[model samples]
Target: MKHYIYLFTLVCIMMSCKKPYNPPVTTTNYNYLVIEGLINTGQDSTIYKLSRTVPIGSAIANSPESGATVTIENDKSNVYALKEIRKGIYAAGLNLDTTHKYRLRVKTTDGKEYLSDFVQAKDSPTIDSVQYEYTGNAENIYSYTHDPKNNTRYYRWEYQETYLYYSPVPSYYIFKNNSIVPTNADDETQVCYISDTSSTILLNSTAKLVQDVIYKNPITVVPITLDKLKVRYSILVKQYALTADAYNYYQNLKKDTENLGSIFDAQPSAAATNIHCISNPGVPVLGYIAAGSVSQERIFIDRSDFYAASVGVDYSYCGGAVITYKATQRTPYPDIITIGTDIPTDSLVAAPILGSKDSLFTIQYATAACVDCTLKGSNKKPAFWK
Candidate 1:
């Protein structure tokens, strides 16, 4: 009887094998509001960026939430309105008292209202230094700071980087007045400044340690092959002290959305936000508002600091095609002389073709991008550039 039962069970298990399972597509709609930015208590301007969340598979990251009435209010009912400078950005000059509690209030174009939890302003300590360490193929930037009162144990950082870039070919001519004229070296758009801001959330905590000291906390890393490291590089780091609640909110956000869809990772959970929809109690709003005075420091790194082996990747792909201009050809030269529209191509001085007559010659030229650095960056140097 036992042998018969075992044979039946094995037959049942073999028959149970079937095709792969396909989960149904999720049809849920999400249009939650996202508020970002801190309430500045210092002399600097306080800016808020408002946007609506998009679907996971959508090509657009976040849809701008525009035409909103944004204000910073204190517990004492003092309100400061922020001007909508652009599509979704709002800005206002602030000099709030550090002792009072503050929050952000928003009235959107759709007539919906939202408010952030009241938060006390936290002051950030000055960064002792912004240092760097060169690994085998990358340079890592780090910051150090400490709170003497041990009040600020949680911290967040944001940084902006600017680098000097140069064109592979120096442009020496411009096509103007229906003729090619020699370009002045001073006005030559060969060198330019390119800048970028931090996107990922960077946070640290010194709560467990006896002293509130953050040492060598890595802020960002620049690969040696990146063009930013090819010449001179500069970074401006801004530090903000966070409340425990605010720190936890950002930490959870980083884990859920920032590192989503990784195998062996924690299951995704909805990040709790301090903001709420005043018009509807159950509706979800995304983001946390923190009140604080930001501390900033800027550092410049020269190309001489790196090893020759780690200089930079070859950017020869930038420009190479050569067009020969001959005086003999008529019919008003082709528009190919310019890069895309107006920018003129560069002249190859070393390999100019000499004509039979002493005064006649043909010159080799290439596209504007290869010769104009301004195509990728600004020709004007930054005021803070050293």
Candidate 2:
């Protein structure tokens, strides 16, 4: 009885001590203009993403700044306009003169203008290769590069990974007219290619080394059980040349966005940027703009390579277990061939009931996500796919 009384007192104290804690960053509205992108002098398109910072507790991830007139201004009085392809994304293929200096200029819908410091066009060295290797527990994908001229000591990289994934079960029929019918001849529902871009900053430097060479910097890690290993996968790595100031800015950004997690971790610091608001000198803008040509390299990985080592990959979570539905006299035919709550897989066969006036049919139904690959990714094949 005494122990129960002590436990009750402790529980009451614990419940009473609980209170909601709100941080300044979460409650404070510190929305500021954020610019991301570089002036690409290479064959690739130069793209920019403009957004506004949001509170930590806000439901939105980013607030895009649209209807902005963005341009690339050169020191020689030449200006190239960038068209807005998406909400806040601006892009254009600039035939920039390598001898001239360039800067980014932005005009917001709210009549605010921003500009970056004029910078020289730096040419990026070609990547040596992008390859993947099994690392016991997972696959490590890496990129290699070197600047023979030693001009590009600082570098940054970004990658796009595409993988061929399939549904748990292939559906040859589709649900139509309240019944099952053969899928269209041109439709390919079982196979698809999905792609994703790198979100974290990838930066490297060889300033301290004797030669400006980086060998096999870890670019991506693929889990052994990922669906990416279930079939064919490819990664496209793009490299950019960066100045020492730009490198330091990205280092600060990495510390701010990707570093802080626990109390023992490094605290967030102010990120450096070359961008400034021309309209209001005191108004702060986030981002670093540099004029550079991008270098690219691509590599493909085959599932057969993994199978040789008896490694396994899974896509079973797509769903499992289909139900066989049968029609009866009470319910002669279902207007919708759904099995319980499961969606119709559009697979069925008519079986005449022995000595019965009504014709009975059995239907197989599975989750729509399981039967149709299009539910998860585009059914169309990627343009670069073999």
Candidate 3:
């Protein structure tokens, strides 16, 4: 009887210690407006990207909020209208007074209105230098800047990177008129340029420091194994001044979106936005707008900057195969070198035969992605490229 009692007690303890607890399924059926971008007070054109945020289970994050009337309003009642250059993207050139405060006014296609809080245009200090440090397996790019007035304490950064790329096997020929032909010297698919924009949220604050100085604030890191470091690389860094409120909002957003999924991490929370829906005050908006003048700087890094051991000689899976010319009793001198029709699909590289003599003998072939730089990037160099 005592054994039975002990067994029952143990069973009860085991039942109470269930491993998984599933909360009830909650659905957010309403889409919320998400406004992004800064109002540039300088000579540069100002652009705002508007979109709608979907549910947590949504496969797509950005549902563009189209057909919206966007405007910039100042304290003196001066209004500047922005035209929709593209779907969900509104742009305008504004030369507003630096002393006056500015705010954004937006009216959605659904007839709902929204407004951003009035903010003073903060001036971004010039970036003193953008330097890099080599660490274990990666290179960290850092930015240095300071505000002489010590008033601009908060900062934000965005960057665009362009890199030169080369095809593993240079394509010197083109298939035309049912024959292999040599391409123009300049038309060879040997080199190209590719560019990418920064998507991560980068922010810094010097509010607690004695002087408004940001020294060696790391912006981004490039792993040594990344293809971006395979050749000449250039980065254009744009810095923005932000208010304390804007800084905190971005910080919260970074934590909510980028810092999740860790076991010890806190649960994701809603990020606060300055823009609000006037029609339905209870509806959540998903962005913060700050008025500021941006400062930009560009730097280039060559392959020589990389450590010898870190350089990647084989960035792509590139190899060549030879397809021999075959003549049979049934078919005399069949065209086995013609890509997409005669050559085995696996052996066709879209490029012409590796050499003119190969057309008479066995044809040397490769993959287009491995031999054609145009498949990855443009052969025309960017105007800013040096």
**What value does the lDDT take at residue 344 in candidate 2?**
47
Provide the global lDDT of candidate 3 against the true structure. 0.80
Candidate that would win on TM-score = 2
User: With candidate 3 superimposed using the best TM-score fit, by how many Å does residue 178's alpha carbon deviate from the native?
Assistant: 14
lDDT of 3 at 266: 79
Please, what is the whole-model Cα lDDT of each candidate in the order they appear? Answer: 0.84, 0.81, 0.80
Q: Give residue 191's lDDT in candidate 1 (0 to 100).
A: 84
Question: Using TM-score as the measure, what is the rank order of every candidate, best first?
Answer: 2, 1, 3
Model 1 scores a C-alpha lDDT of: 0.84
Between candidates 2 and 3, name the one with more favorable lDDT.
2
lDDT of 3 by residue, 95-123 (tens): 77789899999999898999988999898
Task: Put down candidate 1 lDDT per residue, 1-386, tens digits, no spaces.
Answer: 99999999999898897566666765455788889899999889999999987876777876998899999999999999999999999999989999999999999988889998899999999899999998978899999999999999999999999999987766666555666567675565778999999989999999899999999999999998888999899999999999999999989988986786556888888777889999987888888999989999999988998675866668666554544444444223445553243343544333335654322223456566676677788888999999
Q: Which ten contiguous residues of candidate 2 have the minimum total lDDT?
A: 332-341
Better candidate number, 2 or 3, judged by TM-score: 2
Instruction: State each model's C-alpha RMSD to the native.
Output: 5.6, 5.5, 6.3
Q: Return whichever of 1 and 3 wins on TM-score.
A: 1
Candidate 1's C-alpha runs over 4 A off are 1-29, 56-62, 173-188, 324-331, 335-363
